[model samples]
Target: MSRVTLAQWQMLAAVVEHGGFSRAAEAVHKSPSTLNHAVHKLEEQLGVAVLEPVGRQVRLTEAGELLLRRARQLLENADALEDVASRLAEGLEAEIVLAIDQIFPPDALARSLDAFSEAFPHVRVQLHETVLHGGVEMLEDGQVDLLVSGLSARGFLGEPLVTVRFIAVAHPEHALHRLDRELDLRDLEQHRQLVVRDSAQRQSLDSGWLKAEQRWTVSHLDTSIGMLERNLGFAWVPETRIRPALEAGRLKPLPLTAGGVREIPLQIIHRDQDRAGPATRAMAEQLRTSVAACAGTRNFENIE
Candidate 1:
C-alpha cells in the first residue's frame, strides 16, 4: 500500500522537466495550482521536500533527484504497458514464428530482427534456422507465421527476396589446390566433400552432394564452414557466409573449368497473408527492407 500515485509522479516530472509549475501546467493542459497541489501532496506523502525555492524557478532537492529519477523509469514502464494493451485491443499478435533458410544473408537477418524488436518490443519471436526445404515444411505444417526460403511452398505464392551465390571453396592448404591445374568434377570426386544435411524431419533433400569418394555430412552450415577452414573438405558454400574466409585467404575458390558457382533465388512467404496480424506483416516488411539495404555493400561474381 503505497501513498504516492503514478499521476502524481507524472505531474512532478512535468514540473521538473519544464523547470516550473507555470510552464508544466501549460504544457500538460492543467492549471498551475493543480500542478502545485499534486507536487505538494506527493512530497507530503513521501515525507520529503522534493522541491525547493531557488529565488525564482523551483529545483529538485537532493532527495527529489533520486526519487524522481526512479519514478521516471516507473512512468516509462506504465506508458509501455498501456501501449501494449492498446495494441492488443487492435489485434496485434503476441508472438511471431519465423522460419528462415540457413543460406540467407546473416547481416540482413540481424538488421531486420533488430528493427522488428525496436518496433514491437513486447512481441515474442521464435526463429527457426532451417536449411533447404525445412522452411517450406514449416509453412506447410502451419508451424510458422512467416517463411523465408530458397524453395517455394506447394500452395502458397512468394515474393522474390534475393539471389544467393554458392561457390565451391576449400581451405587454401587443401590438397586440391596443390594440383596447380584447373580442376573439374572428376578431380573433385577423388577428394573428400563436406555437405550440410537437410534439417527437415521428412522429405529432406540431398541437393548439393557430389557423390565423392569420401563425403562428410553435418547438420549445420557453420559445421561445414569450420571443416572447410580446418582443411578437412571442400563444399559449395554461400558467398555471404564465406566472404570473410575468402577475404582472409583462409579459403580459396576451386578453379573449375565450368559449373563452379550456382545462384539460388530466395523468397518471402506468409503462412496466410490475408490472415496475418500487424506484427507478422511488419516482420515481413523489415526483412525486405534489410535485404535491399544490404545488397549495395557487397559485390558478387556472375560465374557460369
Candidate 2:
C-alpha cells in the first residue's frame, strides 16, 4: 500500500472546503492544475475515485467523504500540534481546560474568568460548568486542567476556595411558608422537593436533605431554582443566587425548626500541581482571589 502524504490531504481538504480545485488553488496560493494533479495522485495512491465531476463543479464521492472527514481531523490535530509547540517555545500554555461546579458563586467565576482573559490574552480557555461529581470526574478523567468543586477528589489534595450556604427556600405563597409554626422534617417531607441530580456518569450521588416523599429531579441548579420561583416545589438553593429574590419577596427561606441552611465547602483541585503550566497556575490564583474577594468570613484552607 502507498503512503498518503499530508500535502495530498491538504489539497483534498482545500478542494472540499472551497467547493472546487480552482477556488482551493486560489485560496492556498497554488495553481489550479497543481491542486487537480495532487488530488488525482491521492486518489490513485488510495486506489479509489476521490472526486467526481458534476455539471460545472466537482463533488466528493462516498469514499472521498469518509477520507475528507478523517483528513480534516488530522489537519486540525497537526495545527494544534504546531500551536502547542509554538507556545512551549515561547514559555506559554496553548490552552487551559477548567471545570467548575455549578454551586460556585457565579460572580466569583465571572470575575476570575475576566481576570484570566486580561492576564493571558493569547491563552485559550475551555470552561466546563459541571454539577456535583461532574467536576471531580472531569479532573480524574484528565478532561480538565483545573477543577473547582464541592466534592473532594480522591488521590488529589484540594484547596478550600469558598463556602457556599445552601438555604432551603420556596416561593412566598407556597404551603411550606404559609405554615403557622416553624417547619420541620415532617413538613418538608410532605411537600415536593426540587433536587438537582448529580452530573456523574459512573457513580451518581444525591445531596442536601432529599427526604421528600415527592421529589422533582432536575439536571441544573437553575432549573431547581426556577421550579422554586414558580411555587412548584421547595429546594435548597445557594444564598448568593437567591439574594435578589429573597430581598424582592419572590422567594423565602423555609423556617425549618432544625436544619434551614447548609454550608458546603468548595475546593480547587488540580490533577497534578507540578505538571500545571504557568497559565494554569495563574488562572488558579485568579480564581482563588476572586473567591476571596466575595467570601466575607469564610476562611481559605489548603489540603496537603
Candidate 3:
C-alpha cells in the first residue's frame, strides 16, 4: 500500500494552483527543496509520475489530475469535520445554506433573512432562489441545509409554510382583454403563452394550465411577468409580484372560463429534522413567522 500523507497531497495541489514549486513553497510557508522532496517521494510511493516539466513551468500528468481531484474532496471533508467539531463544541455554525422556491413571496423571504442576519450576526448565510422543482432537488442533493418549496420530495415530511396565489394576467391592451368575454382554452391556445421552465436537471415538471400552441419558455417568473407587461405573451404570475402592475393598469387578470387562478401550498423542508442544528431550526422558525405575518394569520399553529 502507498504511504501517501495529506501533507504531500496538499503540497501537490498548491504546486498545481500556484503554478510552480517555488511559488507554492512561498505560499505554503515551506522551503522549495522540501516541496520538491515531498512530490518526488509521493511519486515514488505511488509508482507514477504526477508532474511533468513544460519549459519554465510544470503541469500535472493524467494520473496526477485524477489523484488531485480525489485529494480535493478529501481535504474538503477533513475541513468539514473540523468545522462540525467546532460547531458542536460551541453553539453556532460557520455557515448555513438555504434554498427557497421562486413562487414564495419575496417580501416574506426578505423579512425572514433580515431577522436571521440580526439574530446570527456571526454565522454566514448563503441563499439560493430556485424555480419549480429546483429547491427540492437542491435539498435532495444535500447541497443546501434548508429548503422552502411548493412540492415535497417523497419519503420526506415538510412543514406547511404558506399558500401562494397565482393569477392569469396579460397587458391591458392585449387581444384577450379586447375580447371582453370569458375565454376558453381554445382562445388561449391561439395566443402566445409565457411559460416558466422547470429548473430540475433530472425530472422537469410542467405546472399550471398550458395549452397554447405558441409558447415562450423562460427561466424565471420575473421574466414571464416582464414579457407579459411588454405584450409579448400572457402568463399565470404570482399575485404578490404583479400587484403594482395590476393597480397601475400595466397588467390585468385574464377572464378565463376556467383555471384563472391557482393556489400553491409551500412548505419548509429539512433533510433530517432530528439532526437539525440550532441555526437551522432558528431559521425555520423565522420563516414560519414571516409567512404568518404575510398571511395576516395570528394563529400560526393552524398552518397545514
Candidate 4:
C-alpha cells in the first residue's frame, strides 16, 4: 500500500488553490514551512513532481492535475464520511420511514427525496405511497416517522404544506365530456366514476367519491389515471398529477358549472417531533422546502 496520506493531498491542493505554500499556510492556519514540507514529502513519496514554480506563483504539473482531479473525489468522500460519523454521534436515524399520500405533487416529492439523499447519503429511506387514510393509519400506529397527507391524525398535529387542487376530468371520448356544456352532479352519477381505494385496512375513507351508480375502485392513483385516460371512467384528479395529460388534451375537464374543481389542503405530520432524529427532521425540512420551491413552477399553492 502507498504511504501517501490525505493530509498530503490536502496540502498539495491548498498550495495549488492559494497560488503558493505561504498563502495556503495562512489560509489553513499552518506555518509556511510546514505546508511546504508536506507538499514536498507528498511529491517525494509519489515520485512525481506535483507543482511547478512560475515567477512568484506555483501551478500544478500535468501529472499533478490528473492526480489532483481524482484526489478531490477522495477528499469529498472523506469529508462525507466524517459528516456521517458526526450525525450518528448526534443520534441520526439509521432509517427513516415516510408515508406520503398519492395525491401529493409528484415533482415536489421527487425533488424532496433527491435533496434528502444528498444530505443523508448513508441513511436508509422507506417511502410508502399511500392514499386517503393510509398514511394517517401509519402515523397513528407509529409505523412511519413522517406523514404527508390531506387528512389529519387524532393526536398528532400537522403543519400545512400545500393545497392540491383536483379537476374533474375524463378521456376526450368519454360520455361526460360529450355533454359539451356545464355538467352537474346528476349527469356524473349516470357515468362510471373511477375512484382510488383507501389503503387503510382498519379505517378507510371514500374521499372524492360522487356516489355514481356505476363506480370502479382501484388500488392506486396511477391505475385510476390509466383508466381515466382510456375513457373507462371519469374522476377528479389532482391538477399537478395530470397537468401533462390535460395540457396534451389526453384528458378533458368535465366543465361542471360548480364543483368542477376541488381542493385538498395537505400537511406534513411528524410522529414525534421532539424525539425525531436529525435525518428524519432533515427529510421533513427538505419536503417543505421542495414544495415551496415548486410553487413557482407548478399550479399548487402553499397552505398559508
Best by TM-score: 1
lDDT of 4 by residue, 106-182 (tens): 88899999999987889999999999889999999999999999998999989999888888999999887777888
* Each candidate's clash count: 0, 0, 0, 0
The parts of candidate 1 lying over 4 Å away from their true place are 299-304
lDDT of each: 0.92, 0.85, 0.85, 0.90
Query: In angstroms, how far off is 214's CA in candidate 2?
Result: 1.0
Q: By summed lDDT, which 10 consecutive residues of candidate 4 come out lowest?
A: 295-304
> Which prediction has more favorable lDDT, 1 or 3?
1
lDDT of 2 at 34: 95
- The Cα error of candidate 2 at residue 255, in Å, is 0.7
Give the per-residue lDDT of model 2 (tens digit) for 1-304.
Answer: 4388888899988888888988999999999999999998898888999899887789999999998998889888888778767868877887999998888888788889999888776689999888888888888899998999888999999988888888888999999878857988888889898888888888788786467899888998888888888999998888888888887899998888778878888899888899888899999999988887766622222211
Error of 4 at 114 (Å): 5.7
C-alpha-based local distance difference test score of model 4: 0.90
| Model 2: residues with Cα > 4 Å off, grouped in runs | 1-87, 296-304
Best model number under lDDT: 1
lDDT of model 3 at residue 18?
89
Give Cα distance to truth, residue 16, candidate 3, Å.
52
Point out the higher-scoring one by TM-score: 1 or 2.
1
2 or 4: which has the higher lDDT? 4
